[model samples]
Target: MALQHGVTHLVLSAFGCGAYRNPPQHVAQLFKQVLMQEYDGKFSQVIFAIYNDANAMRRGDGGNVEPFEKEFGIKASVFKEQ
Candidate 1:
């Protein structure tokens, strides 16, 4: 639907992973699979903006970017706390 409407970029949040208690790693993998396999080359860019809150920072949630970088062979630019 989005692609059909000429949407070139996508920003995704962690769905079902916070209050819904879904596994973060599994959700990430599913997104990777769909994007790389099903919608490969369809989007100009895709971004996953994982919120960096107190709990996420404490849990090293930034590590979630690793698998996506590894799978896509792209380096991620992380914004650090100032």
Candidate 2:
């Protein structure tokens, strides 16, 4: 595990939300629960990187923005190149 190896920061992808057929919102909520409640402060930072393609854009929402904001009480930021 990353924690066992003394990893401070973690870049987490959307687990089971794609080919595994798991619900995106549910998976986001579960990740928040485990990271915040179960493994509180274990990592210096936890980043969720969601990639959006044409198909995902067609679906309107392809990332965990709302779920993550609701769970963490903060908004996720998007970095754009100028």
Candidate 3:
């Protein structure tokens, strides 16, 4: 309902790529398809919030964040302060 309510940005995730063992590639593709086909240009920005945990990424070749980065063509980097 974000669209109906005039939402501009979105933060998505790799749904089902966790303990459910859903393939990240497939999940990422579906997310891309729906957003591009249905919601393209509807929002100012779309962000995929994939926690870059090494253990969580161990399931697939690139892990949870990799597929999303590839699918969306952007690398999500966490900021750290020294």
Candidate 4:
């Protein structure tokens, strides 16, 4: 249905949640399966935005962007802490 409707550009966000920590590998794999494999060339770009609330089940968390970039063969706009 997405392909039929000509849907392009997918956004995968908020992956830094409690679902990880126990097993983090699954998070990245799921993103690839849903966004990259499903859409393939249908979308010009796919943005993986990772953000988590401080008071959530998991706190003091930072997301890994490089692995996602390499896995998807894309570059992301990220900044480093001072």
Taking every candidate in turn, the Cα RMSD to the unseen true structure, in Å, is: 2.8, 2.9, 2.4, 4.7
What tens digits encode model 2's per-residue C-alpha lDDT throughout 2-50? 9899999999876655545455677777887788787898898888876
Q: What are the clash counts of all predictions, listed in order?
A: 0, 0, 0, 0
For model 3, residues 1-82, the per-residue Cα lDDT tens digits are 9999988999888887876778888899999999999988999998887654555567648778778888889877855435
Tens digits of per-residue lDDT for model 4 on 30-79? 77786656666777776777543333324333335545556667677765
Tens-place lDDT per residue, model 1, 16-75, is 555455556777788888988899999998988764444433446554555456655778
Stretches > 4 Å off in candidate 2: 18-21, 61-64, 80-82
Best by lDDT: 3
Between prediction 3 and prediction 4, the one with superior lDDT is 3
User: Model 1 — TM-score against the truth?
Assistant: 0.68
What TM-score, over all chains together, does every model reach?
0.68, 0.70, 0.82, 0.51
Worst-scoring 10-residue span by lDDT in model 3: 51-60
Give the Cα-based TM-score of candidate 4 against the true structure. Answer: 0.51
Misplaced by over 4 Å in model 1 are: 54-75, 79-82
lDDT of each: 0.70, 0.67, 0.80, 0.57
